[model samples]
Target: MTSIPKTSRRDFLKLAAAAGGGLVLGFHWESAEAKIMNVIHGGTVAGSDISFNSYLSISPDDVITIFSPNPELGQNIKTSFPMIVAEELDADWTKVHVQQAMLDTKKYERQVTGGSGAIPHSWERLRKAGATARYMLMEAAAKRWSVPASSLTAEHGVVYHKESGRKATYGELATDASAIAVPADVKLKDKKDFKLIGTAVRNVDSKQMITGKPLYGLDFYREGMLFAMLQRPPAFGTKIKSVDAAAAKAMPGIVDVVTFKNNVAVVGKSTWQVNKARKALKVEYEPDGAAALESTTDHDQIFKKLLDSSDPNVVSVKRKDGDADAAFKTAAKVITKEYQCPFLSHSPLEPMNFFAHVRPDGVELVGPSQTPDMARNETAKLLNIPPEQITLELTRLGGGFGRRLKADYVLEAAELSSLIKAPVKVIWTREDDMTGGSYRPAVRYRFSAALDAKGNLVGYKLRGVGINAGNCTREDNFPSGAVDNLQIESIEHKSPITTGAWRAPITNFLAFAEQAFIDEVAMAAGKDPVAFRLDLLAKAKTTPVGAIKYDIDRMKGVIDLVVEKSQWGKKKGVSQGFSVYFSHRSYVAQVAEIEMKKGKPVLEKIHAAADCGVVVNISGANQQVRGGVTDGLGHALFGSLTFKDGAAEQKNFNNYRLIRMKEVPAIDVHFVNNGIDPTGLGEPALPPTGGAVANALFKALGKRLYNQPFTKQEELKGVSLGERL
Candidate 1:
């Protein structure tokens, strides 16, 4: 029997003990793989060594583990990323297991998961990771059989010598393959040769998730760890004045109370006790007295003032092609409309939380974060230590939607743990997450179109005003290249209230406003909405236009697919709306169908078509499309956030409306496979949904809505389409 090394992961934990005698957490792939390898070998090779790479490991018993480097925010990248590797590896899907990789900047680049860039950024790298492994295995087999590597073929974790009728499992050759030199370049499988890329593979974590297993950051725990809850300023533009924690300290289960920055934190034995004590503590806050924070009403007036003003300080031209003023002056008719969208909260299912142990020797931080690399670096900066001293592990995120891209929660846990000199888990109450600001910036847009006497579009103009958000216009986006004279301008209001990226960012609401404006212009031009868009695309494809950012062919591809799939004009007695948008490098088109219920318009179904290149996993792709569309529709119809005196007016679901399960319309998803590299799917489908629903609603009600949360309009106020049904 071979002698296996005894210096395991647990032993290393003992090696890295802190000054206070607490164990410092560390992870090594070999030490962690021992138990898993044992199971695969049926307790035979429990102590045997395995061949592994930075991204993958192959046990002698045929268990192939692929490490997914990107953070998973329910985007299914965890499953789909590995599928990309497995497809190129030609590994059997049944023998594969996926694990989330810890933060290692040297091992993997771009670990962040926001902007739906994970797949597109990692596609080639992951494919090469697998192909390199397969190439090494083939080389090993070729050496053993005395045949050229070019003649040896690898398939489904096996190397075969077809001429000699000899075959060996990848497990049997893994040891030799480990010694083989990895080729600098290996051929990637053609898309048509893939068996797993387009297949509907089940999510690896589905069973564990459905069984209510402990997987998310909230579920993480450490021995001798204390739970913490924070008491932050009640409203934006406020700072802590005083803290009285005497009564809180007397409360049962209370451990200690401390203040950091401008916030008070309560430490206790249990979450319930910590939460109860946190609320019991008395904390006073005074006005920060910086720039006056703008309420929703203030933003409304500010946006109105900036829309028509050309103040050099507030307004700047984003893009200009030809002379828009000259074209508008010569036009026969000009149509103008203004649209507004309120601030929105991410409201992911899981509230913010993180676990941290700030030991002297090293730091162990674990939690759900969309940007784990940033969290690690920020924590290191806060501790005044090198980033390599920190070992950060990622847990499955309950929900992110770009909210976890910020490291405030993670930093809080790190700072609290450092302050208390113990392992700590910080938890945020639903109220805390909601009231703690990081909202989508509220924005307003004014669009004007000029038409010639022949009913052809001659010029276009757009001016957007946003609170705290910079440059709220996608100047190079669709329709920019289609018009002869175009101008886009942006105005910014520097409000004190904090706001950050939310899902699709500016395009989330911009798509709706722009698409709805296009619908209106189409009506004014006496043309069908779909035909009008197609005409613009055709002009963009053929005519000389100033720098188009989107692919005209892909946009038209999705538009054609959606039109064909939805039977756009074939359905009778049903009001239909059409919208198409290109965002995040992907093109999406949607058609919303509304059937009249009494006098109210009830959304019956939505058809979505996307051209995001090749679909890695059909099941996950479909889920993303459906989820995005549902989220977009719900927010367009009911989502709204307002501020009063620099404080969020709605704190919980009761006041902050979300679309009910009963309100979700049936959604059908289709993908256009053009054999190109995958782009973004998580957010592309969402941007067009609002426009589709709004356009359909216009047809149903014979009135155009210029603002979001259409329910806020006088015609829709207090009217529930669900209640009508």
Candidate 2:
């Protein structure tokens, strides 16, 4: 059971003996939140007690505490999610305190963050939660005033009796409010009535960040903790034959050099000591087959290979419209283009780290993890403890971009500490973090289309190859089935490297490539790209993206809104090209102006627009929009991770360049100002940027760029032309 404090800027502390001596409770709401008057109950969402801690909480002090289950990796959900509930709670924005909800899946299940689905998925549930609490408080006040519920009105955390001019604050009714059963169907406010939502709000935690409060995993601290760094294989499929730990064991602060699982780990009093000892320790091993992996696979080659190859196991076909094959066969003119994007890394500012205290009965984990649900299960497996005994304490993330979802590092920490018989924290150096694996799987995409005798639209076809995304961001459970005629296939060039979710999952990369190709088709047909996309959306919405893809109408609505905002088909610069893409239930369109100077592409400006249904925490949503766009720009310019003789060639930022301040052109973001519940604006904004830039580049150069390492053609020198674009 939880209790709300009666004073402003206070806290609700739970002090149960954790089944047998667990964590202590201490929390405080900042003074700024004392004026909040919203009553928001977390339970009764979809009629379940399991998710009570998910959306929002209230204290007797009038402080509104909003729960954001997902990790805050500088994307600003800390502010966005709260603004959503605040809109319905009628809580004064000045009195709201956004809380970092723990990684308790049983309490706030589905806390894992990725797919840009955080806010959109939680929108209705959170709003409904707030609305229900308001109803409960209103009922309590209505009874006290002996007035009809209809006659009593609530605003800004206060319930008022209009006729009598009497009022009771939501906090004053908190005690009585808790005793009542939740109304069967709490009434929600109409969209037009919203105040906080659909409005740009500043980030709730920005001040804390600028002030250097302990927010991310990098700032995590524990009493008497030992640090460890794992020694991974130099290449995939290789194992250490033996290790020389003599030098490491003698080093100061070096606790022990031990082997866990297949890798050697050096433990120390500090990260620097552990890292220093790791370098001093030497090992030899038998390398894997990927040792011969090369950066030589050019764009055109792999794209064609994916098309002509017959390796099945294509798990999904997301979308297809009309008789594509027949249209292509009968067309008067046919143009086929191929595209390729190399592997990428999440490379979050804070590299992966985890703190674990392993006891005989169970384990406790502290640090940042996107999926606490998965963490519980995986930690249970590694610790050989009951799933119930494992407790996960999630902290704020420096960054994720889909990397923290995997619980490998958490398990590793627990396993190492359990053996050492002490609390331990595992830290990855920038080098270890990069080489440790689980990167975005590189992909090859091929697109083809046909134009009729009249040059009207006839058909579209797509073939994708390389590592399958099913290995990571599996959407088999999505509302819509996978693609159609879409022919999404894969061939695994398995390496020792592990791969997991990155950004919007594998479908998004395909969307970026496939959508850009479709844009080209529309241009070849002399049809407006926006209108052409709408036609496809109409078919997909009515039909479906094969079995399941996503909400088609919602997707189209966003795209349409973007076109209206971005002035689709209007030329900013005749040489600039534009494209649009949809992912995670959001649509984004970008028109990039580019110029070819001495064979180098220079982007001049970008106009971006999106429809996320509703806008929550305007500042945070806009930040994500801008950040995701810039992330795409960096990738389009020079970000490409390739393998050579089974080793990743691009070691760090020097070679794997990100978009710097100088490269970022003027980016303009506009939203569909509707308070129709909240939707997210993270990864959805990224998928379209590359395609838009590529399309723009084509418009400027009069030739298509269908390969990655955009300018690293030398790597593909000896590679087969079919495998190199």
Candidate 3:
């Protein structure tokens, strides 16, 4: 195997060691995979220079720095991602610091840092890197002490020669250790041997967060950088016809006000000045799509129309099993429920911002985003430059929640600044960030379960409607023959809203709709949800659901863990809800305890269990689960995007709601401490929260909410979706 050239990563670490200060690896080259495996695992104070992918760096001082790829918003990735390296490197956990890696995709693949794929996907690789480094260090120690390397053991950033009882800090062996050959096929620590994987570690960036350091996109500024804010069209698809920048140009500190094809941008010395000047600019827009937009407010009627219209078009085939139509006709009982989940904005704490310095040779870009590689490609294309010329420096994001997945904002900022041949920081006001944001599509799910006379589930049919993300048309997804008969269909409801991946996999909304419906079906059959789920899982393994979008056994494992910890069947007084989901190579289970707090079903607590393969940092993993649950709470309790005349109605936080600390109950997270491997914590917990909360709400009212934002709106009729307990 061609090993990673030891030159790139180690070169920088050696320099940092010589300086005698904390070493920060701000990777920007793109992919660091070319580096050898052994260099990564060895503990050291010397950190190597990495492409965009490098997050964790060990100093000659043995201080480990993890440049967090994902934006923090509130999820504790700053701490969690580092925990993985700490686990593999066997470094002193307390010495770990999570900084921000720059946006360079070649360096870090999928560093977009959403969909809950980070820790899980990186688990094995990161640990292996750390282990490789450790092996080389052992060899160096053996040569110095005149003993075999096998006799030396590593623990807490020190290499110990067991024979002589001599120990050396990681820093002491940094130089000699670099000369050793990269160990081939190193031994990885088993799950049973993990000290950090199963235990909760404090977030490495917590102190910096609390101290209000210069973290997040908005905090990013540099010498001679201008601030630009756009005065976008009042409505979507409204193109700029003409602009008169005379008045705005007179405003003090205003650098330039230029009109692009779609909107007008006001560049000035500060964000405040540009924002103030933007409001005063004069521009004419030709409204395009607004004329075709529906003015009706009856979203319910629209949902009904999509549901009853029978058209079989497989826009994207996700899952299919048995002959659902045949089983439905012969079933003794047919229970159908229609549920609707509204559109939601990610609403990360720090609104989108990017700094770009456009030069004749190359350009520099900086910001927080989920898909860093995508951002690089998009930015490069917009600047009319090659990817190599555009440097994207990743910063600690305030939050991602899948919002940063699309890099339109990054492109817009860079494009505007590149045209002017100057350094500029594009700052999006909360309104633009919200209204102009890419939103989670409003979705409608129709689920029907057929049961035999003996109460054995025979068939299932699902009709789902949304933006399709795949196409304008919806399609069937239930796996073929997973049941005796299964029918899945989809329809398209066009919207101006742009859709991207949220917390879990592509079918997050559908998973919740299906799982929650299954719970209700179990109740109808007077059966335990777990028992019913197990029965389906058993059949699923033998004859599985629509397309096997989920793993039955892994789902069963997480469910069992949650059920055991939650005391599922015995839940009383307060309504208890349970749900399990599998997506993004991760399986997760969640149980939410709900009670009436002044009529609304307050999410009192959440018990979550996840089999993410391996636990890199137990505390960090738990933190992701905790944050994901709360994120789902927001989606369930109050996250929606409304449009009128082809423009988003919610302009800012006041109109678009978010779950605050007051609404956040203490979340309890537990990991399946098996040595299976690792997945991600960012999104798994989100998809399941909706299912769990909805099920609990079903028990409390004996009424099911078909749509999300379980809020009190005139739309839900008299039975408010968020009616108090």
**Tens-digit lDDT string for candidate 1 (245-309):** 99999999998999999889999999999988887888988889885755889888888899979
User: Which model is ahead, 2 or 3, in terms of lDDT?
Assistant: 3
Two-way lDDT contest, 1 vs 2, winner: 1
Query: Runs in model 3 with CA error above 4 Å?
Result: 1-17, 20-82, 95-99, 103-107, 289-291, 294-303, 310-320, 471-481, 505-508, 542-549, 595-603, 713-725
Pick by TM-score: 1 or 2, better one: 1
Q: CA shift at 4, candidate 3, in angstroms?
A: 25
Q: Could you tell me which 10 consecutive residues in candidate 1 have the lowest summed lDDT?
A: 18-27
Best by TM-score: 1
lDDT scores of the candidates, listed in order: 0.83, 0.66, 0.69
Q: Give residue 300's error in model 2 in angstroms.
A: 9.2
Per-model tally of clashing residue pairs: 0, 31, 82
Candidate 3 differs from the real structure by a C-alpha RMSD in angstroms, to one decimal, of 5.1
lDDT of 3: 0.69
Clash count in backbone of candidate 2: 31
* Runs of candidate 1 exceeding 4 Å displacement: 1-53, 148-151, 718-725
Q: What's the candidate order when arranged by decreasing lDDT?
A: 1, 3, 2
Evaluated at residue 284, the lDDT of candidate 3 is 86
